[model samples]
Target: MPELLSPRIDAISFRQLRLFESVGRLCSVRRGSEECNLSQPAVTQSLAKLEQMIGVELFERRPSGSYLTPLGRILYSRVVRMLKQMVTALFELEVPGGQVGAEAIVHRLTRSQVRSLVAIIEHGTFAAAAAALQITEGSLQRAARDLECNLRKNILFRSADGVIVTPAGIACGRRMSLALQEIDWAINEIDVARDIGESRIVIGALPFGGSVLLASMLDEFLATQSKVDVRIATESTSEMMQLLRDGKVDLVIGLTQETVGDDLVSQTLAETPYEVVARRGHPLTGQSHVNHEDLIKYDWVVGMPNSNRRNCFDRLFIDGPKPRTPIATSALLFIRHLLAGSNRLTLMTSYELQHETMLVRVPIDVPLPCPTIGITTRADWLPTALHRDFINLIKSRVNTRSIMGVTRTAA
Candidate 1:
């Protein structure tokens, strides 16, 4: 954003990182300087700053040339991928300036300008975007203006409906968001390996996604991974799916979708069988075998509408009378408490109620299907070494639980 970023001289800059990538590719500081059209001394100084900032030496300086350090090679892969995404985004910005291709566009734009435009698009208002970035509104506007002036295109203009982004701006902002995603992953990969800066990973979990596995692992992860920032999103499956696609979440842990999109990949960890349940002393608790007719006589609680579990609940009585569903909720804690207090029944999995003492199975003879619990990540996702190990640990734990004789549960 500055000749070098301010507020923190050690902060990463897109320009400096691009230079680092150049040197990594050429394996010669002089060649990197020539390719970037910068003085060799300036290139060396920028690389030094980057190395100091990351607390790791990226290159082995020698008379012949520069060579990558061990960590540098691991980091180089992510940076290369990041630049490729940026190049693709630049190519897509052929609108507004039909004469400017990716080659020309990359030369004309600055990281700050792209940052401002992306902020505007994401927040829908310059004021909000500025606040989000912790910068002045005037500075944000100036950056956006410079972007338009450089490209000779009006990215945004005031209309009766308020500010409107031109098609070029929309395209640029959309693609840049994706490019920024690569940047995020790159940084996450570095921080995790270096263990010096904060590493962040967001996990999206559906309501019944064998999230209990997360509880035990979460405790150990927090106790151990102090520098790693972990965020869990317990939103609906659809919301989580969209988040995963957009790179807002690192991965999703949930019921395996019936059909995964081409851009997504899923792995089955375990299958849990679903069971109809009621309070320990409920009338249906003593039934040797209960049918839909007997079960519908009392009030019940079910999962959120349209959820896989709820859909399965619907099929239980597909042939006849519907039960009086007094409540519909996805929160297991609330469901357990509500069932304990009322005569209401519910459909649940053994894994979900593993430690509960009040609820017991309402034995039924129907052919119940089980849900497969697993992890879903972007097909393009490239996890850091540590990240991959963590996911593997989850899979292994689920399998171990199954081996220990935990019943397979269902959605």
Candidate 2:
């Protein structure tokens, strides 16, 4: 059996892991340096140290740029998952009481190294974690080193194959996530103990969460419950749901019908159908007899693959000799911008179209399917009094479909 790359490894700081993530993702030294706000030499040095610590060349560096090796890709995926969990852990709230006991473990780590490790485990990588914390890669590296010394153990396992959490490191990481949550909860509980009613509610929502359908509910809730605190977080579907489940936020508002797993409970709020749209004055805007071939003549911008609207667009355009291949595929904002400028046409949720004034609905003669949008909660956990009220408010205000099949009532 190949010995696990566990013990022989000294500590690698989260900062170095972050540097690796940046180089791996951006695939350019200069670009990664700019994003990480580290000097070129500094980022290079960190990467070198990280590679040496790990004993594998994670990247194939050429004059043109850097590319992830096979091992690098595998490591990147795991790092992303770790970062997501850590971020969620940070927002967790602890039980109200005296501070939890800080166990003195033998690990070689620094304060920066600990922070960097926690940030990376929470946020997914050096670039993303750095971006979220608003710090430099070099600084993060230094901190990670400090944490290792404090802990008296090598918390991060570095190798040419990529960095990972050793058994001890994984145990430590889990504690960090949990303790952070407890700390947050303790702070909130202290506020309550002091007879302070200033409770903050955070809601993680999908891209459409900020739209008119949900926006009105938020406005109404704020007007009535002025004393309650509200913070809205916008992210992709997976990120928002993950955050919700981790207890990083109070609730998640968005499409929550069939996609949620068995461990989640979903509630229907509204039904939204896809509408084929174009710029205000596009040539084919008002044509009643338009076909897929005619639609394919224009440049197209579609949603990212696997997205409901993107899949719908593909299905609608598949009959023609040459399907309307997307020039670019991304989030709704990008699709809207492309549609608002050039002769591009793409699918938009009715809610999205309602928000953008520069777009006009291009009525498709055939059927374009509808997708339901709502909220979800973990089946195992119950929401607090405030979150439940917020959920109810969402249920109440989403009743305005004023439009036809475009907006319908959902569970």
Candidate 3:
């Protein structure tokens, strides 16, 4: 894997990949050369160099013609898809108003420069990011500077604390990160196609979706598709949004907000209502109607500050003084343990408490609005075939009824 991701491996030009793809498609060096407008000798030498660098026999040469080896077939498919994505990215980056300089800037930007910018943003400091990339701070600085010059934007500003990324810089880094992810996804897809290893999908799971929807779908998905890897991250919506923007997360499964940015696309699967819950034998368990005054008498365990759940919790006491949040966290497991051992109250989705024997939903009719739960992905994201299949599976598992009492389409 290290060898595959080495700088030497990445240094293989897009032109080389295009040539190799043409050769594989045509199944003959002479024909590929004719199609790509290159001499047969040049094509042969380029393919030979590519094979040597990858340390694989891509083609079997014979008197009749050239044919792809098993490895060559796998790489050919990946190269085709990757080249197509590259062309699509170029088209997407093109300025609609016919700015020639924008196209030039896109061409000038390299993978390494984009990588350095993303690394700096992720690691929080240039020195730390340089250490992670195993490059000198000066080299990283130069890459950032070159990227800024190419884009004609001030990407970063130096402060006494550290470097601060401008809003424009964050936007640029997000696009670059997404582009790099597309390349990596293609490589991983090729590996999976060859049965070399499992392809991984990283999902940012918010509390509701993790506990309800994905919890039911993951086991079946993994059991049936053994060659695919699934990673679930439970985080606040804001944090998950950042991860999605940076391409660290393939998709987010959670409650959908009323207003999402233009860059993100949301699919509403179902409407999920929040319910008050406590220990089974707790005093509030049998209450026919528990009001905010009754719930405020005891200590509360709530979601993280500024979270959707916390916001809803705060609104419960909007006309009165806010209740004390003795313990504020986002971990559902911890919340369960904390509620079971003590007389504390917390709000969660009904699905979250379905499998828990220790916690029971309080019979309080809280008048909070139900939020729509579903999947969130980048508007420009090009999902692989496997990703599309998994997403469809998730959609199949979700119930269509909206919590707001209306039947809405999943889309």
lDDT of 2 by residue, 76-101 (tens): 55444434434333223221221221
**Which residue ranges in model 1 land beyond 4 Å of their true spot?**
1-11, 37-42, 90-100, 146-161, 164-175, 181-195, 400-411
Find the 10 residues in a row with the least total lDDT in model 1. Answer: 1-10
Which pairs clash in the backbone of model 1? 272-408, 272-409, 272-410, 273-408, 273-409, 273-410, 274-410, 371-410
RMSD of each candidate relative to the true structure: 4.5, 19.7, 6.2
- For all predicted structures, in order, the TM-scores are 0.82, 0.55, 0.74
> How do the residues 284-330 of candidate 1 rate in per-residue lDDT, one tens digit apiece?
76667788788888888888877878888898888888999878988
**Predicted structure with the largest lDDT when compared to the true one:** 1
Q: Candidate 3 lDDT, tens digit per residue, 1-411?
A: 223444544666656777898889888999999988989999999999988766668899998889998778767766665554444444444433235555445545676777888788788899999999999999999988887776666778989987767765666565655555544565555556656757678888887545467887888788768776678877777888888876778889888866669989998887777777788788876666888778778888988877878888888777886667878888888898998898898887655655567887776665765767889998877777678888989888776553333221111
Clashes of 3: 1
**What lDDT does the true structure give each of the candidates?**
0.75, 0.61, 0.73
**C-alpha lDDT of candidate 1 relative to the true structure:** 0.75
Q: By summed lDDT, which 10 consecutive residues of candidate 3 come out lowest?
A: 402-411
Better of 2 and 3 by lDDT: 3
